[model samples]
Target: MEWFILFIVGVVGGVIGSLMGLGGGVIVVPALLYLSAYGLIGDISPQLAVGTSLLAVIATGLSSTLAYYKKGNVDIKSGLLFFIGSGPGGVFGSWLNGFLDAETFTLYFGIFIILVSLLLFLQNRLTPVDLPKDNRVMMTYVDAKGIEHQYGYHLPIAVIISFVVGCTSGLFGIGGGALMVPAMLLLFRFPPHIAVATSMFMILLSSTTSSLTHLYLGNIEWILALLLVPGAWFGAKMGAAINTRLKPVTVVLLLRIFLLIFGLRLIIDGLL
Candidate 1:
């Protein structure tokens, strides 16, 4: 029953996460924590849940990224730069996670979720800042339907933001896509599809590194991860297909609603 539950959760998480470029950690982490609290997982620690989520994110990110890449939605150069900055930060965050107790971790995770929710809610209301015309790292991308998008961004700012996103991902076992996608959209003026696709690529790198660090620290539950991967894989492909058909405003609204609900739930759980 527990394994079945994990699989179902993975399916749901992967679908929503892939659509929004999130690595499904927001869904997986909270769900696992709830199962553990209810004695379904036999006293599993929150840290273990988080670690397993990160491991599962590897599958989710890889599957979604491949789909996006084939559709030409991914921005490889930006994603690579983000990955480079995030790598060390991921390692450090994993190491830090080891020192936190379950209660403290839960509390902080709740706070983090709420903060992210607020950011998502506010993102659509904010005015986007365009990159200067003369920027050296301008990007022109053609999507699956042969639609072209042109944008530019300050590389240093992106790198710095990615480093912070990596740390958050490692700490919470999230893919950091929720944060990264919004930053790419608002700060870098990236098209919504491109931002989501690129975020998945970056999550692939960040989650892998973070998961390995958690593995070294003995935080992961391999059986749980095994159960989650298959569902996540199938769901990711479905979600990627759905993404290509959805409007950007619709996607953002869905993400905002999910974040708000999940974030509030986490906060309530922590307090109680």
Candidate 2:
């Protein structure tokens, strides 16, 4: 029963994370913590939860990146550039994660999740930035509908943002797409599909680095991570397929509500 639930958690995390490029850590880390607290799983500490979640996230990133790439949504050039900063940031974040205790991890993760929920709500509301053409490094995409969209960013700024995203990924086991996707949309003017795809590419790279760091620290729960990988991998493919087929507005709204409620629960648990 526990194994079944863990697989389900992985599937759900992969689907949602791939849909929005938000990374499965938002789902995986919290679920592991909750289950561990109930003693349904083995003695899992905060570090183990984060480390295991990141491993699962690697599957999600790799699976989703492949799916997105076939659709021509991935911006390979920009992804490589962003990796310049995100790679090191992920390493640093994983190192930092070692310092956190259970109570502190729960509280901080709760706050971060709430902020992520709010960020999603507010992401579409942000007004577009007007940058001079010469200052912007541009890329253009033609969507399935044959509509062309132009997006660009300041190279240094993009790298800086990716670094911060990577740090959060390493520290929290999130793929860092929650912050990265929106930043790409608002700051870099990336199309939604492009932002998500590119963010997943970045996630694949950073999660690999972060997971290696965790592996060295002996933080990952190997058994749990293995169970999660298959589900996350396939679910990510399903998510990419669903995204290309239709927009599930109702599902997204409900997901936000779940995040809010779950995040609040974590805060209460930490306080208690």
Candidate 3:
């Protein structure tokens, strides 16, 4: 029964995470924690849940990234830059995780999730100002459907944001797509598809690094992770297919609602 539940959670997480570029940690971590709290999983701590979720993120993110890549949505150069900035940040975050106790980690994780939810909600309301032509780096890319998009971004800002996202990923076992996708849209001016694809690529890097660190720390629950992987892999492919059909606004709205519900639940659980 527990294995079935974990598989279901993995499917849901993989679908949503792939669609949103979140790598599924947003779903997996909370679900694991809840299962542990309910005594369905014996002696699983928040730290272990987080670490295990990151391992799942690696599989899910890679699966989604490949799907996105075949569609020509991934910006490899941009992803590489973000990866460089995020790698060390992931290490730092994982190291920090060791210092936090279960209760404090739960509280912090809940707060972070709420903050991410608020950011997603507010993103649509904020208007973007055009940058000077000289200050921006131009991008031209073709999508899965052979449609081309042209845009520009501020590279330094993107690197900085990616670094922060990396830290969060390492700390909480999230893919950082909740933060990175929005930042790419608002600050870097990436198209929705590009943002999702590129974020997944970054997640692939960040989650790998964090998972390795967690493995060394003996934090990951391998049995649980193995059960989750197959579902996550299949769901990622489904999500990548769905991404091509959905409007960007609809995606954001759905993600906002999902984040809000999960964020509030985490907060309530922490309080209890």
- Which candidate number would show the highest TM-score if scored against the true structure? 2
- Please, what are the lDDT tens digits per residue for candidate 3 over residues 1-272? 99999998888889888988988888898889888888987778877987899988888899999999998789888888888778887888888888887777877888888898898788777765566677767889776567787777677776788888888888998889988988788766788889999999999998898888888999999899998888888888888889887755776687678778877777776777
lDDT of 1 by residue, 104-207 (tens): 78878878887887887887789888656665478887766678877777777878889888988898998898789889888888998889889989999999
Better of 1 and 2 by lDDT: 2
**Which candidate's lDDT is highest?**
2
Q: Is candidate 2 or candidate 3 better by lDDT?
A: 2
* lDDT score, candidate 1, position 167: 89
Q: Which residue segments of model 2 deviate by more than 4 Å?
A: none
lDDT of 2 by residue, 5-65 (tens): 9999899999998988887889999999889988999789988998999989999999999
Clashes of 3: 0
TM-score of 2: 0.97
Which portions of model 3 miss their true places by more than 4 Å?
Answer: 132-136, 143-148, 248-255
**Candidate 2 C-alpha error for residue 56, in Å:** 0.7
Cα lDDT of model 3 overall? 0.85
